[model samples]
Target: MADNRKRRPINRPKFHHTTFATTKLHEMVEFYEKVAGLEPVHYGDEAAWLTNDDANHRIALLALPGLKLPQDKGHTAGLHHTAFEYESFDQWIDNYLRLKADGIVPFLNLDHGMTMSMYYQDPEGNGVEIQVDTFGNWHASKEWMWYSAEFAKDPIGAHFDPDKIAEARERGLSFEEIHRRCREGEYKPEVIPEVYLPEFW
Candidate 1:
């Protein structure tokens, strides 16, 4: 007799930061700086701490040898990846274009009804998602995610093209309009790549 969709954690814990173990420290640092806009807080050859805000460090990339990389085509369970959000659609588009110009692109881009997400592969084969809320605010987004029939139909969402999204934004298409068009399959990509599930070694 109760509304289950409205149920949520009473005290949601805030995400602090993420850390990664990698043998290629320098490459990881560069990738983080470009992708996450993070700068070094305490950097060294063996370990480095990076942050984009006052948190001191949002991500830590450490150097470790003799570590086996996650096997492709296997189900590995440890950490999938970390996601970072942008407040505005324009800002999100700019970041996408910047990454595209630098030859860094997301492997998967989806319209999840509530959010538009781009998933990229890090230097260590880790996934990094950059997303923007389609609804502008968390309150609206949460409501939509909870009750929208569109979400219930296909939660995996419609795959789209980043270039097409950027063009739509640049052409003065409203965020609402773009999202609607996306759902209607206007910007759908010809081919959507299959996400690789890792195998714990």
Candidate 2:
């Protein structure tokens, strides 16, 4: 079994927040405020700062003079997607329902073994991920990041079975249990996994 005591420094200082440049800053601010429950703390004709908690600003909306409309082809060029974390499954569901109530259907909903997620595009087609971690249910037997890559490739229609995941949870499975089985190589490696396991020994 690989030693699990090793820790690595976080790259890029972790995610701070995401900023969106929009031609209509007020519209962007309104969308974020109503849909994501962000509180608009400061605003002007061309910019705004929205916060959800203690962070000075979690999402910034900047007005551009002539921002072009996003192409619908799904290629974001430099940015792949942005994800937000929720502490509870119930809160996650609440967010999901709020989006639905606003007649905004998610692009996709997925079970990534380590996380369950809903994918969506903002008013300007910026990809976003609203996700809840499974706490400790990540597959430990093999590289699961391949599965994550697969999910990213088809963010809206990757293979995810809710019943299968529910069964795993119902059985009281833990990451330690999964890791033990993975040490024995009991599970097939995902085509593209979502989580990375260290090779410490």
RMSD for each model, in Å, please? Answer: 4.2, 10.9
Off by over 4 Å in 2: 1-14, 136-201
lDDT of 2 by residue, 104-193 (tens): 755555555456666666666565677766553335412455555754564333333323333444577654453234233344334433
What TM-score, to 2 decimals, does candidate 1 have? 0.87
**Poorly placed runs, candidate 1 (over 4 Å):** 1-12, 73-75, 197-201
Indicate the residue-level lDDT of 168 in model 1.
94
Estimate TM-scores for all models.
0.87, 0.61
Candidate 1 local Cα displacement, residue 187, angstroms: 0.4
Best by lDDT: 1
**Among all candidates shown, the one with the greatest TM-score:** 1
Candidate 1 positional error at 118, Å: 0.8
- Writing each residue's lDDT as its tens digit, candidate 1 over 24-130 gives 78988999899979999999979999999999899998887786665652245666668889999889989999999999988888889889999887778788889
